[model samples]
Target: MTAYESLGAAVRFSNVSVHYPESATPALTDVNLEIDEGELVLVIGRTGSGKSTLLGTINGHVPHFTGGRLSGRVEVMGRDIATHRPRDLADVVGVVGQDPLAGFVTDTVEEELAYGMEQLALPPATMRKRVEETLDLLGIADLRAAPLRDLSGGQQQRVAIGSVLTTHPRLLVLDEPTSALDPTGAEEVLATLTRLVHDLGVTVVIAEHRLERVVQYADRLVEVADGRVRHGSPAEILADSAIAPPIIELGRYAGWSPLPVTIRDARRAAAPLRRELAGAFPTVAEVAPPPDAPASPAPGVTARGLRVDHGRVRAVADVDLAVAAGSVTALMGRNGAGKSSLLWALHGTGARTSGRVHLADGTDPASLKPPQRRSRVGLVPQSATDLLYLDSVGAECDQADQESGQPPGTCSALLADLAPGIPHQRHPRDLSEGQKLALVLAVQLTARPEVVLLDEPTRGLDYPAKDRLAATLRRLARDGHTVVVSTHDVEFVAIVADEVIVMAEGEIVAHGPSADVIASSPAFAPQVAKVLAPVRLLTVDQVRAALPRNAI
Candidate 1:
């Protein structure tokens, strides 16, 4: 009898190991695991961890699609993946990757949803019915006729998911699906997935970095780290791992019997602790800039009555802002709330109907030449690859050196500091998401511009990589550069940002110190603040420093 014929598991791996051609060690080493049918599993780990390698094994992509050496056996739905390629397993496994824009094959949403079903050679009537059903299920009926390129990041994500769901596969695999979405959109996507798991009996496997959004819905948690795999319940796995949500850390700090994964459970566990520290004020750090600190005769950059339009659409309207030298500012907002347009306007590149940007010399930025403007202001857009279009990594770095008027190895040195170990001879497209962002940022920094801007810099980075990025931004600020970033990662903002700017509907709603603004906003608050509030603490490290020895 076949193994899966007797057992109810959807996936099984036995003594599996994978080694890339250029790597020294296996990405996954001696791994044995089984995922039961109708179970929703979550995979968590640091970047370059074996999470992707493990996820790819179920569909035969690790050994078959990607040029890698595989050992041992993998079975999905009672079929050995070693003998069956991905196309043969299409009816059983459906995969969706990180970038939705790259995944879609058609220009319109409706056509993109139908393309997969057509490739499978489904009946025409069945394809039409399934396309409409998926559009309604994902709440994207309004965008059925909309062009895929024109939609916002969150909308594109919804369409991508719907396109894959139309196939009715028994096993679904998603890689960081909600990384591009806002809070509300992320919740919507998760709710849809939850329904699919419970009502349709489909098996779901997801690898995601934003644990806060997916942990509550997970039936089982699998962690890939240090060339091994660990599996347990959500609380059991997160109890010992450093990567956890704010609520989980709060439960650990209070010495609760079991870690809480949801806000409701956390509140129930913290009732006694809340009563114990009713009137206590947190030890505050000096985060806000002094009023007199930027008291010099000129500000680093100034924008007054800034207005941007896109063919009768006011993407940005009447925005005024300023930043002191040597400060790191974070721009945060919901999807489609004008954050990207504002950043582009400040860099003197996007559409500007009426606005004036002045540097310390009181010169309008719009009047400068392309070379002169780039040396003064540098921007890394959401599509970072747009800034990188060379034959190889070494070639790109060399070109950056020439454009910025820096020495021969200046860009190479900066890239090493940002993300070491990237092969110089490899193609830029072969690098991971985090590595790509680092390369672009290093190239921009080679110019030593007075101002630097990044849009969604944490899109696909893991926790360890984020820590390194935070440290680099801090160093840049100390070196007297005005750094600004547009992102939705509240945890990252807590660690790196000195100032916070909140935008809504093409206007600034609040601008102040990072600690105060983040603490006040419900949507923007970090994990630590959610649990330890009334105290206004932002990180677990701060809470540990403030608590007494016997508190735990």
Candidate 2:
């Protein structure tokens, strides 16, 4: 029998504290926690709040892989992490990082899934059986022969999870596992994870920003804030926590005795609020153009007969759309539904088989050079770090200012505006996923481009950070800049998007205002919309505005 079988808990931490080099603050401080076997723990925190640091301690990556000072004891599967390296704990621990591509070891989906089993020297018959089972479990069987690089971001995330599952480890540690997936795809992965914990008795720990998607499935909630950790049941912790999902926020706003964490509970409790809001129509704040804009503004972007092909697959097909000059449009769809491809084609990057894309001035964006393209339209791709090559954040900001011909510290100022308090000297790779995205966003906005396109922009941001980003996009629209965001965050879309465009099978399936499209569709509806159905409320803020002063 293994050490974990003798011990009661799957993982234990006793007065754990981690300190990195050249950092005055400890990443984790005096953390005392224990995770029982077969428990599914959800970790929530703001951007750069050290959620990842706590997970790193599980598999000995804290001090073993990353050079740092680790104090106190961290035991995983009853083995002290201080003595065991990451590879030493491989049999009991399987980890998937925030960036899935970084962990991939092979070229194709099938090979990547079997790579871990091969490393463990499992028998050929067992490996083959496990590989097929994992592929089917994760809903990636059709992609067995597909190359890793060609798959969409969400597809890559599934393969990453499947790769570690084939090892049959006792503990699974995942960072933002559903960040890149669409709503349906996220459900499939989460359902599979829930099954693993219940049926196979796997211990799962996940750190995610989109709490609405994972909070309902959590057996316990762990909140990491400023190097401290707090743990309890999902309802118990979220009741008093500062960061909460839309569902919890709605429950609190409606004065429910106990805050609900799922749509069904909230819906059962929302009847009174819906009655109060009867006949009240939701009002969206209008964004007026800046004073410098022309009296009759041209369309921000216009496309016709756009198509993007990849080998035998048609990623985007004969799409036609127009975005207003001062508006925020959300491009939303399931994974591999052509959202990212359309954004790339619009920005004059990626492969475009045939299309006509024109800017406000009726200029073809694809005709411009790289530098010229930046001035007209800027793009922050799904992999935000791919845009950063410099060593330090300060150096990157300086370069962006120089290239954009903006004043020195221009990019730094934007960075502070988006995500404040990021260290200037820190390496881009060393920063959390959310921090890297902010840095890239600041760099791209330095040029003051006419049109901005961001793909999966909310992958690692917290609730407050998302609020700030929403305010920023609203400000951009008010200033006569065009903004387009392709994301799977339905709540975020409800907040920021003036227009919603749904794509499927490389075509525009639904096009209309945010409320009409999102509220009607069960798959894309936010928690508030789902809870207060028929009333058409999309966010907590909207619900607040519609209620009477005394009711609040």
Candidate 3:
């Protein structure tokens, strides 16, 4: 005889399918699923795999706001979504989109948290109590007075979660909830979500690309692909799913029975595999940088005593490094660790107190005109969509071609190479995050700068898109372009980076060859390294190459 006993399934979809009028293909096809109350579900899929489309239906955004052809029934908390628009269902469902910054309605952390409740017009005393509770629950009490824009990407993400959480909705839906967070921050958020599900009986559904951080906590896994929806226990879905974390991939590679989903589980079962490769300890020498590589080249990017500050805060302090031509350097660090600040400073953009960005060709990037600077050294910011505002994808490509002074179809050609078969007439806003990223990347690469800087380049990319991006970076490096990418994806760094640079509190703490540096830290190690530690392998392909023929 409580509120929990009254509700049936938190969300139920019966023969639901969606097709955008502008799109030739359906985003989702005949999906039928039910999420029971208090269950925690993880939605997994490749980019543009209809995961977003599925989540949108629960909160009444699919056909209501998106103007899509949605057929069938979607009921949340015993209320039909066909009749209840998002505003009407606000009390039962709360949604947090991928780009948290775009959804902000206030400047300060506390203000943003309270803004949602104010829309519902709750009593002042009730709103105050809920706001305080949400702030403490999300561990952002210290940031209440801080401006939302000034906070780190992770901080902004926390505020966004708290904002929706203040509503006390029965169901919470999130898209890429931890995409911007560091490893530690992501862990904290997941733990908080776990507590909410167990204690309050709140059902939660989340879509995430980094399955490594989320799968173990998932009560079930829901995969959307090829116009189908498959739901089952995490192990059953991941057993054959193409979209998976490094741990799952490792489990498959070694043929681990009942596949381990977490690091602890993998460790307990890795003993036999460990023994097989004992005394085969890979020498640091084997993975070390090429001996003939230049320590410092005149025609490369260099920084001397570089420092960046936002007001009185020293985001990056006195960092010195050299990026040689024809190599990719990955900047790895935790949230608010100054990786983004350093990348922006290096590219001669963002705020800087003191920094000397010396380009190889005897030019100071900061001193050049904005348009001239873009052609000489291009940058794709953390939120790539900020650079896109044209009416259609084709228009944006045309603008990039004109701006870069390249051939008319240059940008379009690059876009096709990066993301195939994207409708040129589609609005950039309607594209998935991965597709948007690919578009911006194509726009920048068309300029053909000698030095290219990308912040969180793999934020929303799927496995295949990541593979394609790796190949693109390799091609750029082969053409003698210096590529510096700041990212939290250790697996990606393993594949594309020649060097790894670890940052903390706005300074470079460790710098070495990619394989050597990644293998040294437990938190930064790729799944392959964690599984085959003694062998010093960095990727699955490396393990395949090292093992005997027909070993599997």
TM per candidate = 0.90, 0.97, 0.94
lDDT-superior candidate, 1 or 3: 3
lDDT of each: 0.82, 0.90, 0.85
Candidate 1 lDDT over 395-480, as tens digits, reads 99999999999999999988887777788987888676677888898899889988888998887787667778888888777777
Using lDDT as the measure, which candidate wins?
2
In TM-score terms, candidate 3 sits at 0.94
Model 3 residue pairs with clashes = none
Alpha carbon lDDT of residue 470, candidate 1? 81
- Sorted by lDDT (best first), the order is 2, 3, 1
Query: Which ranges of candidate 1 are over 4 A from the true structure?
Result: 1-6, 249-256, 271-299, 407-413, 548-552
Worst lDDT run of 10 residues, candidate 1, spans 286-295
lDDT minimum window of 10 residues, candidate 3 = 284-293
Candidate that would win on TM-score: 2
Q: List the candidate numbers ranked by TM-score, top first.
A: 2, 3, 1
Q: Evaluate model 3: give its lDDT.
A: 0.85
RMSD of 3: 2.4
